[model samples]
Target: MTAGLLPAPEDRSADQGVRVSRSHHAARKVEVTSPKGTRTWSASALTDHGLPSAARRAYEGAAEAMAATDPSCQLPWTLLAGVGRVESDHGRYGGSVLGENGVSHPLIIGVALNGAGPVAAIRDTDNGRLDRDTVWDRAVGPMQFIPSTWAGAARDGDGDGVESPNDIDDAALAAAAYLCSGSGSVLSESAMSAAIYRYNASDEYVALVMAMEEGYRTGVFIMPVSVTAEPSPDRAGNKGRPGRGHQNDGRKPGSGATSSTKPHGTPGGKPNQDDPSGPPPSGGGGNDDGGTPTPEPKPPKKPPKKPPAPATEKKVGTLAPCGATWCLDGWTLDLGGEATLAKAAAHDYNHNEVAGETNQQELDGLSGAKVSVVVSFGTATVLEIEGLPYP
Candidate 1:
């Protein structure tokens, strides 16, 4: 197994029957996705006490991307979704969203970050490029990333070349990656606490996020009942599409995430740091663990000039936005012929251990195989093996 940044333990708060801070108000049109396709439902029919549909889609999308991009992080999609809810309400904290392509408009910037409150005092690290502040830096985006934190971990999940903190696609992916920085499973109670602490450092914040996640698992937070409806990019994504095709998104290996300040809990095995998340860390609260280093995100290299669907080692569809983790998504693997891997589970799967070319050997005789156990870092413990065709 790839060394975990920190083995995250299962959140104990799951047993708490935790509740979310936000009460659900039925939105007129709530979008949903499933085997049949995309659809929408009435907000008044019933409501889940959690994030809105769009926000939930972003979180689920990030979870899918991270299964390949940051396998070390074992936290479920709900955890990241909860963070987005508490941080900036999934980039809509103040009526902001992906207006064009996948960029969050009306930009989501935090306060001046003066350290007067529970937040730590963090000076400007990006020279006003990200936060637009020449002095104190603030957390930006739906997931609430400070400039420095975004620099190192930021990923262009939309393959837009630019790693904008405001984009929920990139921001959620980066946030999930940041949490996987330590060397333990985040499932254990200890590791779970540590992981949440890394994100915020506040016990209360952890509890709140934990509660929200529990609600999501139960019917408290629900996926819009799969129904027939119009797809709305206005909600979670462009009908489940990741990004706006291939843009030069100028990222480089070890770029994006600028410095080495750990965004979450320190690499140390401690507990209850009392750091509040959101905005910038004032040296105490928020992403101030300054823990260990995670695998640096590699920028997308221009693909070799070739025919469309470049075949051998070429990125296509959902795999295009993924940078260094492209191989993990089975993009380069020759699934014999015209086909791609479809995720068995829509919301639950490991993002890190995605199938790669190396594993192609296992599927060599798949033509005659009735059943096969093909696994790459999705969920390690649960092996939902079955014969699946490459899309």
Candidate 2:
């Protein structure tokens, strides 16, 4: 026997308006424009940190090697730099130097122990313990190597035999190798995120790394959108099952499948109906022996109707300042002000701010506008802007 069909549930009441929170609305408004085109993004998208000088050099050398060895391998240098920034704070660890006697020497160490020299010195008493030395082993060097994991993964990135943890060049090379090796070599956005998780071993590490990576890539830090806003039911023409308040089975009208009763006067069309071709009918419109007449030929099937368009509200603009420019929608407004430029930089605009530059001078004299400023470490640019009264 054929199974009975289940009825679909009723759709949720639209009268009970879905109240979108302010934060959700704000998050949806944030977006970034790249070569791939404009995309919606959250505020936590990119990070503003940088790699230590030592680590940066190491990463460059390693990237060059990878490029030479594997043409298809592509390591995002800026992403690596951003990772370094969050991991080691550009290798500004305060510690004492170690002498030839193997005793700890006292001296506050920054990015370099001396010019082009290996970082040495231990500022904290727990220098020997990886967990206790927050400035040294805690954060490690460029690529943010954990002291516990460094021994197994560290390598000489510059082709020099020595592998120093605090050396930026060595650290960066090690990071690149780690990222491009084993499960990390794929270089997908997800893979990069997973590799970062391996580096930190934190559940949230991927989100942090992605945010920083994206910031370096596009000069904007955005958050991820929540999944709640998407419609629960799959609409017609969508590539999934129509859920909940829709057709329970694949059966739809005009799909060539039988539903309810067949067209009238078409005998034997319904299940268990007797065959009309074998004998004449006993009705009044008879043939030879008082049989009914045959019915007309079946008509051609019609195409299915198109589904209604999904409802969409007008998208509001987000406030993003880069350098001398602020962006909203597709428009950009330039506001030439050092304070404004600095604010944009503080917020992680993807350019640098340098004195005596044309853009810097331009920023020194602007007013009445929202702007998107892209500032690197040393140079700033007015990428775009909007909503400004300035001429």
Global lDDT of each candidate: 0.44, 0.36
Off-target runs (Cα >4 Å) in candidate 1 are: 1-53, 69-72, 97-102, 221-391
Model 2 poorest ten-residue lDDT run: 261-270
TM-score per model over all chains: 0.45, 0.35
* Per-residue lDDT of candidate 2, residues 1-391 (tens digit): 0001112112211322222112322222222211111122222222123222344455566677655543344777755655554443334322333232211233212221111111222233335453344443333443444454455446666556676555566667666655554222436754565455434332222333455455445644343221112222334345343222211111233321111211111001112111112222233553577566655545534433222221211111234445445443223434455555443222212223343434333333333332322222112233232212221
- Judge candidate 2 against the unseen true structure and give its global Cα lDDT, from 0 to 1: 0.36
Mark the regions of model 2 whose C-alpha exceeds 4 Å error after superposition: 1-55, 69-73, 93-139, 183-185, 223-391
Q: In model 1, how large is the Cα lDDT of residue 143?
A: 70
**Clash totals for all candidate models:** 58, 53
| Worst-scoring 10-residue span by lDDT in model 1 | 1-10
